[model samples]
Target: MRTDRTARTDRTAPVDRTVATAVAAAAAIACLGTLSACGPDNGGDQNAAPGKAASPAATSPAGGTGAGAPQPSAGAAKPSAAGSASAAGTRDIPAGAWIDPRSIPLDATYHWPAPAGAAKSVAGAPTFKLQELCHSKLSPDTADLGTGRAAAQSLAGAGGPDRWQAQQTLLYEGDPRPSSGVAQSAHAVFSDLREEVKACAKTAPGATVKVTGPENADYFAATVTVPQAGGNAVTLHEYLTAPDGTVNELAVWTTGKSGAQPRVPWVGPADADVAKAMDSALCTTLKDC
Candidate 1:
């Protein structure tokens, strides 16, 4: 449903075409796949459930994003044991592998998908454009964030102490874009995201966006904090990539109690842990890592 546009790529002259094109594609994907949060519904019936349409304010009808320290694991995982994890390599991996909800680090018993009415709720509000990616200001009005084709977006929120995650994978099985191109695009997205975080500190006082890692070539991630009145806050961390035409993304959001703020700086997962989690989730649908 999303339409592609021909925009200038140079920032000084008009815009940065490379990042703009890439982000527009990604935003279109987000509207359909709900991988990254997007703009409005643009009139089409998205079949989202009717509710108190959520706003762009950190809080969502879906749930609160918490800001707190990570929960402790029982103990450190051994290297050899971690290395043997499935989907560890790029060769011989399966395609369209099923993603087991349990593999994500949340309490499965309380997990739920994204709100049905999510699309309709956030109408007209400018989505968080990766300004860093485009290296230019994007006119929310000119860019149609929704109205794109709907890819199957598998969203779920698990119950736990301030924890929830949304996961979506996109496969370009017959598309013209090559795997290498996809990988390159992923790198660009992450790089811009980091730049956005750096710039946000100055523009959005008190809020923070911290880029974490590539962890390895396949992953690039970050942590976000939006301070609210009464001491409460919304926090989010996400990992995203399109490894060889297959897009794999995971985002976790947590909400802290009134006055409870993030206690420590975020340093993403261990390389091994990231590898294991991505493999376990992707293996269900993909044959290759």
Candidate 2:
């Protein structure tokens, strides 16, 4: 039950500055902990095509939002939080509170009935725009920690007290269409700051994490990220189960590797054996993980 030691996808040597800041702070806390840190998680597919371009951190569910399936497995295993409301409508998600929602990043999924009115934000890195419950259940690594936790804050404008406020997302993939039409994941969510997250709506509650529907977009979404490592405010959550019964989910956020100092990945809760050794080394080097 103690397996969180990985960083050798073939990294060789010369990375020891105290384990390279604890393996880059555990890969920047797993890209701000919980399924994100550097790149390729999600982007594109909110209805898609306003700007369409994420593929950074937090990238999620750019599923086929799934058709041929097979092309939507970039990064989706954050799972940290340990708060324990007992998972049935848990609640905490506010961020900017110095964090500790039991660790955040319950990896994304849930999705049942939520999201009925307004859910579409865009701010990032320097601020935040994951906007009011961007369709509920999001964890896709919170889309790479929403622009490296908003560039790791302290921009001198976030209104004080250890500012680093996270909140990034893109999330899309209810299987709208994807025979590789591109659009792998999106359904992102990050929290650490809060000018106003609408009082943090019952927050956590886990168990496939409480997500709903009617949110917009159709399905099958993706854009890119997860070839070598995607980036940007990182948020990407994805889950699929289609065979007529139904049970699909998506979430995405983006940003990273542009100039450093974005920093976020700081995870400490471990399991899934380093994400099954990063998806069995990404399905043996892209043979399909």
Candidate 3:
């Protein structure tokens, strides 16, 4: 199996395009015969403030009605003293807080195949807020929510006609204070993402973005289609809040054949599947779900 390895950097800061060139080159080479272009970057940040609910919207270049996305549920399980510390000592993240990569469903097709081996762990870094998802602009209040413990994994397609990549991140905020404190912080991050998606649709000229799910839903999905010379690059970004105040992000990138539209599957596993997996991974150490 061919592998493209690049130097690791701080995930908290904006992604450096220079460092991403190697991965991009790998993707381009993988799609040489079937597709003329490669997909977009796979790095991302998860942070935002609580806002209003979001309205369901369709594919359009003029943006969608993502007003106030769903905030963190007040009824979410809160972390306890025992859950906050391990046998050794207090920890930023309790054991088993990170999601299991194998649990996530993959969209393996002839054009875009899934990775053969298990996902590889990237560098861990502090969590920071983003101004929008499409661009790498950082929000002024990036530090307002405070830093959270973060871990990420990257998975590349085995060897397919069309190159593809997937990234998964777990951001855990273990504020032992009551429910409101932690819930509010998580909700804020979700809200920011909702608004950023809307902004990306409006500002990006040749790009079309569609956001799905109701305003009150705990999880929402967004798809961005960027027109390239020979084909279009499509990306699916999905977000959801875990029962224990952890933010789970799944991003998939794929490209279409020349003069064709990309047809990658929606975000990733169903929201229910992700929630169940996260519950099993997090509830053991964070709180009783």
Candidate 4:
């Protein structure tokens, strides 16, 4: 396949422009995406005096909601619709939407944000966040896109004996806007990233960037390399949009420096795998795609 490569200087501008807008929109869907926290312990007596000995009565109150009292049956608690939806896992993903996971590399261990430790390894250095690979720019301000917890997913793999590491993820932003608005918003983000890639080509001096387009007529791929003192890393980013304004992104990057074998082999999915994932019914909400 043909790969369009270039170098660019400015990369953070596109990210800054949309962060404020996207974060603002984040408030709207925060509840939907946020995870539940562990509730505080109820073992302590609320009315106990500091440094005071607890009276026998305080230790065990009759008919109180304490551990000593007869506990309420688990059946008494109510289940929330949101909790149920998240547990279902298929909330946005339609049946048979994903390519057979078997087709992906056998060693690829699917992780939500790659391995957590990978991020902490390169402190005080020019390390890249996984978000940067997918979210280059924010969706349109007026676009009602939902960035729910269930809306994002990722996978990581240890490259086979090559010390290469690969990671891929998808961001499903559900847009509640009308067709005109949804189309405009999706196109806006895509155009923004395209322009950013082009702009980067001219500025990054020695860095190498290859941009390829309209994959399956629905996706775009960009490969970037930023040269540094010791060695540089290569990152492959893929972007896709569904008819219902759901945006899917896929990325795989090397963990090792340029010219050296990677320590962890990347077993993440390939461009074709990413395309298959986007084609699946990811984020197919009721009455939406």
Candidate 5:
């Protein structure tokens, strides 16, 4: 996450504590349900895979993020047939409501859920970003940028536990800092970021987080949907900024789809407690980064 507070809403913005609190509650409930439903997929383990853990991508000497650009489409979406596209005021897109960050492999095939809302966006097109939404409830509103939750280490050593066998992860051997810490500012920053994300999700239909480009910069986002918004399939993006402030690695995900898709929000809102825990974890792990 950019240490820049300027990219976020002001503390004095129209905050509705009560409403936000309620949404936070819903978010917690949703997490429980989701955990129960997806527990199997979580592998119940977080150990690094056997062999050397993948190193975060290296930063370019030019100080530019080296993320590869999105592949271009053959041509503009063919104009809809006279009667195929719904008239204005429609709520969602046609059958494939999902959004594939236009960066799919040329030979890849993607599938998206049928759009359920109106034929078109009521307010505007979805803002597909690629921040870490793994730890947030309000969906893609917030990021998991090298904050919150220390990267776990194996007692045996790098990839010692094997991500398949242990719930703990392997930290970069070259990096000395533990994934967690005992700092207050980090915790405070995490709490603040979570709160802001929760508030933003209220109005946003859905959001996405992406690693800021390929290599450098504090962290960047895809304000508007573009072919460059990669990892739309899994709808998950992880940005790893080197301690030196350069984003060295980024991961992206989204439900595979040819065009836009639907956001399967958690059953309830994201849990407020998660924010507290995440804040503490992040603060504790990365005090100064």
Candidate 6:
């Protein structure tokens, strides 16, 4: 159960205050709903999984290329039309259509340490949700994409609870044509996100959300910052890319300590860098390049 401090309002406040408060509360509820469906359980031991141990030098915050550093995918298999087509005559994103964990770009750019261990495969449903933008009202059907088949990987960070990253690829089935239901849903979700960001910026106080992408591009990056009491804030940086019937999302979370402002020194990858990384994954691993 995640809480957004910016949404809290006094019960005895004026009617206008109540109405304004509802916006953030609604967004928080929507986000929590989505998290319940898609987000990972951050409890228990994060590094308890027994497998190949991550090299300490590679993941160190000093940021150096080493054996444990994430490498780019080389000669990944491209999906075939026959293999991806389902019995319903609709395109299906294959289970293997995931970006190579080693290929994920993690460097000093984000000013954060790499995963403390090798990537762990995630099970069950897709784990990507576009929350915080208040798009729940735009299209109720499109609010959460966890209903689809998915492939995901999680990287657990060392040190504190606030450090971690996740990458997910969702597979939705629909007509293979350009005018397919899957394509339409993808377009509508992105469109609604842009519209909601603009509206949220106007209505929500002490919240900063920015989105950027090339015109007509199949990808976009969003950074959301919600201020809390005591001069602290939480920021989430997410990059989403939709190619055909597949949607890939990479997201990271960071929190500010003391009176530090999150925006002054960003804690995640640059919009352009992460955008290029997602595009590269799509072109190299999942679809035809």
- Point to the candidate with the largest TM-score: 3
Question: In the order shown, what is each candidate's alpha-carbon RMSD?
Answer: 23.4, 27.3, 26.8, 28.7, 29.0, 26.9
TM-score of decoy 2: 0.18
lDDT of each: 0.36, 0.24, 0.42, 0.36, 0.26, 0.42
List clash counts for every candidate, in order: 33, 111, 7, 18, 51, 1
> Where is model 5 poorest over a 10-residue stretch in terms of lDDT?
62-71
Sorted by TM-score (best first), the order is 3, 6, 4, 1, 5, 2
Error of 2 at 282 (Å): 20
lDDT of 5 by residue, 86-171 (tens): 33222112222111212211112322111111112111111112223322232243222222211221111112111111011111
Model 6's alpha-carbon lDDT is: 0.42
> How do the predictions measure up, each by TM-score?
0.42, 0.18, 0.51, 0.44, 0.20, 0.48
The lDDT-based order of candidates, best leading, equals 6, 3, 1, 4, 5, 2
Give the least accurate 10-residue stretch of model 3, judged by summed lDDT: 59-68
Cα-lDDT of candidate 5: 0.26
**Which run of 10 residues does model 4 get worst, by summed lDDT?**
61-70
Residue pairs with clashing backbones, model 3: 48-188, 48-189, 49-188, 50-188, 52-68, 53-68, 54-215
Query: By the lDDT metric, which is better: model 3 or model 4?
Result: 3
Candidate 1 lDDT score at position 274: 54
lDDT (tens digit, per residue) of candidate 2 on 1-289: 1332344622545555557777666776666644343235453344442222223111121110111011122233222122222132211111121112222233222111211111121123222232223223333553332321111111111212212232222222222233221223222221222211222233411112222212232222221122112422222232121111111222233344423332434232232222232223212322222
Check candidate 6 and list the clashing pairs: 71-102
Instruction: Give the per-residue lDDT of model 6 (tens digit) for 1-289.
Output: 1344434543345777878999989999998987776556533333332111111111111110000111111132222232222332122233234444443444343333222123322332333333432322344665443333222333333423344344343333222242355455545544654555445545455667776556556567776665656666666566666655344566665556634553434444456666665556445434422
Cα lDDT tens digits, model 4, 50-138, are: 11111112111111000000111112211112212222122222222232344334335443332211211110111122224333333
